[model samples]
Target: MMRSRLTNAPARLFSTAVVSAPKPAATRPSSDKGGGGGSGRDTLGRRLLSLTYAKRSAVITINKWKEEGHTVRKYELNRIVKELRKFKRYKHALEICEWMKVQEDIVLQQGDYAVHLDLISKVRGMSSAEKFFEDLPDKNKNRHACTSLLHTYVQNNESSKAEALMQKMSECGFLINTLPYNTMLSFYISNGQLDKVPQLIQDLKMNTSPDIFTYNLILTACLPQRDVETAEKTLLEIQKAEIEPDWVTYSTLTSLYIKNSLPEKAAATVKEMEKRIARKNRPAYSSLIGLHAKLGNLDEISRIWEKMKSSFVKMSDTEYACMISSLLKHEKSEEAMNLYEEWKSVSTSGNPRIPNLFLADYIKRDQMEEAENFYNKMVESDIKPCYTTWEILTWGYLKQKKSDKVLECFKKALGSVKKWIPEGRITKEVFRNLEEEGDIEAAEQLLVTIGKAGHLSTEIYNSLLRTYASANKMPLIIAERMEKDKIEMNDETKKLIELTSKMCVSEVPTCIS
Candidate 1:
């Protein structure tokens, strides 16, 4: 289960060597007799899945499959592409789509173009995807493509763009189905725009019938507002629509009941959740375990865990994480640690998130030794530390008053994350220690890194100035740096700059140089 780190390249710039001119058929692999279903031999899908590096191209695999004289069909290719997307192999998926487009013998359907467009939005950017959509022929700009672009807008939190796209979709009469509406509802609920759900539901009823997914999200919207009455009404609406509620429906209701302090009703809903749980649906099991824990039914958690073990031949990392998290919540650290060891033995994905959970708990409990040991274990096992890992370690070092280690971990934390704003309190504490230690160089590095992440605040700039002033050093280009960072100079900043100037002339020979 070694995973490839995902990287985004231009979707259109795939390998053309194999795609444009494949090898002779005589050089075809002798092992691939008939590359059809149910043969159980090595297939193209397996080869594509085996690629564990971002730089490797799926196009090479497809071209090699062609050169091997194997039968290739659009359906098979589409299936492989779908599976690749499911595994978060967006670059590989887009490569397959790109190869399909260049095939003169094959004609892509509307759905294929839609998937390609969606992948472009992911691998490239929204603007590229928008251009792609705009260039599509009128018929190809069907519900799927429009909805795909709309989904991109929602994902990017471009609310105005999303709304405009939805309006256009309605005008094009694409609202006859619930898919687009479901995407919108998901966007609204996730963005905390709960008040918009009812109106959207009204629009949904007017246009198309609400399905189980629709009502499930509607129920989810009710939970945060503690609106049990609305949740019940939504459930009734589901019944009227003759749509059976799924596991998520029951799970949301169970949570709502718990939130409203109707424990008996929550208990009843938990039973309903169990009835709806499909044998292979792991999320349902996780939800049920969480609900049971919320109801103070500790025994039920063990029973559910056992049931999950029996149901799945192998537990996924997510399932392990969920169970570990639930156990930790109930003060079951010993049991959680046991599960962590079990997961370590079997886990293939070097995901840092699971390890971060234990690191967080250990740091929270002030068990720095255990936290350090577990973190070292993760590093030994090739589980690269994510931002949360470093953040947890930083807090642990903060607790120990190890200023140097705290700043070191803080820098690593910032480096691990793509886009993050440092917490004001943590930043303040780190700078205070940095100023005391007179580590002007370290303070400057942190400031530059924070500025690169687009969070160089006035307070941060002031902190840096204070560090320089306290160290009897002059920040020679302080004015230029602040102007460039667009940090407005306050009275304190002016005073610090003036004071440091005097100190440089009077006391500090190094600063005068």
Candidate 2:
């Protein structure tokens, strides 16, 4: 949810109604349609998730349910959209944003408009995003909207545009908060443009007091250079400003200590992280578990896991994924396997990420057999793997020079996925191997899968076509298909066609016929 700037905040459009008691024997009507113990809100969440799965239009589906007498509060819609975004279901999320735009039942707030802008930016493009901002009424074009657009530019690393936008925001008197500054500073840190950050910090201090996020960005700037001195200086500045470091601050410091090879400092920072972890702060505990794993503090990792299991808190998908990843990182494969089994037992729907952590770790370690074994088990149990999983296996097989297994995984991948961005270097290496061998059959098989998935481009198609033409057969068929797909052949593709023609001529019999 977006936050509102002060004074320009949206007006409350509705009021609660006072009611008199109906009768002594009467009970208040339950909002739940089933009149069961479950909260209507909980049911609404499940219903929304189902709607997403069924590929229904979120706005239409939800409005239909509302018309049928189901309760769909505005706040619940916010929560559902947030959750859907977290699940990477952007299609449904954008629909809800569209719904909020047209729904005239309530007054639209600055935060609402910000959410709308961000979603539209993601689904559409920069032009649409600018149009959305331009279309907003004057009152809505204050700090939140300005910052929302600023965030879009900074996120994409359009540095000149972001800076230009920030300058415009200041000129319009809409730079009323430290948030946009913090965002730009964070962007600078991300791009390793730390030198430009000092001026921004100075401006932030002069105009408004910097928040914890600003200090955290300063801390992040020290990470790439392993500048512990500068990191300590930032911490001192934070303390001087009477701002106590929160979890993010401490987490950044912990990373700083880890990177700087100061184990004791990192250990102390983990203690600080633990203090912030209330019993139900599963992510906090998860972070601590991962930190200890990094530090090789296996005992602490086990202690935290034991605490989580003993506590009354319900473990989330994030917690399980974190703990599993931590265990694998620390070489506790046997223990990780046992924990994974427990997770599977509790999670009926299964978690793909849990297995992926192990898959990725095994791949990194070059333990191809183990990675394959784990992947097979996941498939056997009906837990669907994502594209990255298949890409990793394909990459591993390519490294081992197992062309057949590489082709096998590529086939399996097409069944489960539509499009995925593979590691460019590894994919190219595989292309090179298949091309040199003139394995036209294997090359065609892969080309067809990714082609239908619509991942083919001029560069990718050229490489594959060159390989097919190397075998001196069916080059025209592939070329014709590429043309049908509306892929414009580049100069490189033209050269490959010419080379194949010469090869075909050289192979022709000299005898008259």
Candidate 3:
């Protein structure tokens, strides 16, 4: 249960003011200005839409209206402020907030003050929020501004201020709802002053109906209390409160059992957890599966797997991946492979980790044929292989002495990753594989694939240059290609180039010599 710092807004803002019927000078919709008495609503909307991050953007547009004897309506200014916050341009959001305070036409509401305090708390710190709150005209202190102050105290760990303000709120009857109470509960939880929790919760139960979160906090406090007995008492107390125990309560209990090495109790808690929530809870299910795996209850793991697949819950790649890992743990590789195939057939997106898990198991068994078949199947299914997937294949094929297949897997893996973030140092693995065989054709094919994908990096290109140099082939063309790609020459490039020159004269691989 989270609390918002802003007060609830009115049903509408800037209602049309009354006027004598003879003149018919009345407000209208924002779209139709209806000739003059300038409000600058149009300019506010236009400036926000421009989406410029420049300092003068919002201020300059509003100031022009101010210079010409026009001011933006309160509602229009609020809309721009909200839009800037939504775009995550907090500086502009505060700028719009500040600009609204000066406009004669914009009469700031409590909600406006609420917005300002929250923004100040967000962009600046709680110190600024306290100062702003202090400076507020006493009329602005509503439930929102007051709670925000309590939150500010909570944020900065001003325990004394928070308790005082919380006392003030309780006396003023601002604690009518559970939100403020939950905030205080969270504060106690974060600060680890849980001895104060039971008393606070007892008071909460007497004055206000404690929700599930309040009970969950009590449950969380059990582990630190160093006894499962506390959790059980808390659960009974929760049921006594007529509050239904949710998955969180059960999950916490299950975690408690796991923490104390109580597998049977943990399993019972997971079963109860499964019974409570009607829909698919992936995290809970995965946790149960993992706990069972850790206990070596293969039969239980299998039953849970079947239960998960039959349920209405859509399985994620992680769920499938975890299942694959569990099966591997239990030496059920064939079953894991079949499950991977079935999962891949209906899956909408590909996850590299799943296949990599399968590939590792295959390589460990020296089942190169199966690994090759698996790789081809993944490619045919359009599930792209990442570096780990390709690396294992490279190692497998090199072990089988098929240098071409090693480079083939390397190109496919490198070509698959289209994201702009540089891939990690798997290029070293590829260089080692190619370097051993000294196969120029494989290196040439890899360089061609790299160029087409436009994934050039110093390590990747240098790996190839080193391969050429070790094999006594001049890599002048690779240097030229690096220049064309605008990749700057690093020390590795220079060292490889100089080594290649020496190799051209000596005509032997360095490792051989």
Candidate 4:
């Protein structure tokens, strides 16, 4: 793999034609039979055309010309497919290849074979791609194919199979290149097969002496398991090899220190990272915020935020949200509210209240009215609230024992998540809660409203049964409701209903019945 002389010169050579004369348009008349005229083909063509420029149309026209008995050279097709592949037009490219395979007297060169295998592998047909490799002529079995195949297996979580193939390649007198070896080592590290690192390192060192990437992989593998002593040893080995650690190395060390509850070490690593790198980066700041937040050092987090406010490494929405949430978590409600108002005033593009951090802060202080006002402001600004926000508001109102506000919040939440939830469960839970508070008429009205909406779940039926059992005078109404709703009670729910019925008859009913 590390021969003084490069053997596979063709792999580096520009085999693809850099400049080719464009073929004249096909002379044959257009026909719907072989072209994309059917529903499936039309759909494919439409999607292809939707991309920027009419690139998809070029692909379809090229394929159409070939289907209509017009001569199309391999170079022409390769050029179009290459462009399409760059745009992630995988499905379209695959369709073109499948069509080409059926034509007469067409030979796919090694480059075409490699590209086809890559496209297929991306579409999750690695087994089919492997079969394609097996069918390749001896001359085509080069480093590119082997490396790509190994990567495919690794991506698909078939590391054992990838290892077998690597061993087979070596047995056949094919030298395993650094590319494949590095990929395999990284795979081993990612999958927690750290125990195998010694053998891998020995093999590489004896053969090619493992590059910077190989050492970094070994170091990261040590970090995740909190083997800090081993990590330090690996860093020393890296320095002995005269290979300086890169951002990945520094970031991994910082993350490991933070994970092990050593914030001071993590912070020191960040300082080293800043000295090593030419410019500041986001990861260092993110790690700082995370470490400080973990240590409950809000003052340090705030200082970092201030330092990064106008830095090149800008704060992302989630990062800003995290800072506000941290302030709230530490009972700095006034500071959180002040920051929220400041962000709102400075945000020129959109509504700042869409994020839940402000709502969370208000709820932390048991200020339901303020939270509700913020929610209303969000609605008035035409910013669509996510399901999470609705869920938070619903639960928050329930905690405050504000039944009317809970009802309003539930209605708002239902508008967003109703289609995704079991209709019966929402209706049953709402009605059951209402009836438990002695609002039987309101519960029945809500039941009628949700029944008009859509299908309900069995949990909703159970809630209705519980509500009726609690009333002690609605047993017949419960049976009628279940029958009318066409709800098939599961065995467990049926047992509960039976047990509740017996209890309701023998004693004063409870709200949970």
**Top TM-score model:** 1
TM-score of each: 0.80, 0.71, 0.45, 0.54
Summing lDDT over every window of 10 consecutive residues in candidate 2, give the lowest-scoring window: 12-21
Cα distance off (Å), candidate 1, residue 229: 2.1
* lDDT of prediction 3: 0.70
Residue 105, candidate 4: Cα error in Å is: 17
- Model 2 residue 479 lDDT score: 66
Instruction: Quote model 1's TM-score.
Output: 0.80
- Between candidates 1 and 3, the one scoring higher on TM-score is 1
**lDDT of candidate 3 at residue 349, scale 0 to 100:** 73
**Clashes by residue pair, model 1:** none
Least accurate stretch of 10 residues (summed lDDT) in model 1? 17-26
Two-way TM-score contest, 3 vs 4, winner: 4
lDDT of 1 by residue, 1-513 (tens): 101122332222221111222212011122322234444567886777666676899888888988999867888788777766766778877988999998999998888889999999998998788888777776677778878888887787887677666665665566777888899899989989887777777777777888888888989898789999989988887888788888899999999999999999999988998998888676788889888888889899999999888878898888888888888888899999899889988988787888899998988899999999988988998999988788888878878878768878997888887778667787888888778777777777778768777898788988988888778887777788789878899888888888887766333224223
Which of the two candidates, 1 or 4, achieves a greater lDDT against the reference?
Answer: 1
Maximum-lDDT candidate: 1
* Candidate 2 C-alpha lDDT tens digits along 217-250: 8888888889889888888988999997887788
Can you write out model 3's per-residue Cα lDDT over 1-513, one digit (the tens) per residue? 112223343312111111001220111133312222245555556655454544556677677766888755666677767666665666666778888887776678777877787778877987688778777765676657777777776776777667766655555555666666777878887778886776677656555787898778778877765579989888898888888898778878888888888988888887777677555455777767776776678988889888887884567888888888998988898899898888877787787788888788888889988887887877787777777787788778767767777777766666556643444555566566677666655665666666667666787778777778767876545567778888889998888887776655433333222
At residue 236, candidate 1 shows an lDDT of 88
Once fitted onto the true fold, the runs of candidate 1 whose alpha carbons sit more than 4 angstroms away are 1-36, 42-70, 102-105, 348-350, 369-384, 400-402, 417-425, 428-454, 463-481, 490-513
Alpha-carbon lDDT, every model: 0.79, 0.73, 0.70, 0.62
RMSD, one per candidate, in order: 9.5, 10.5, 15.2, 12.4
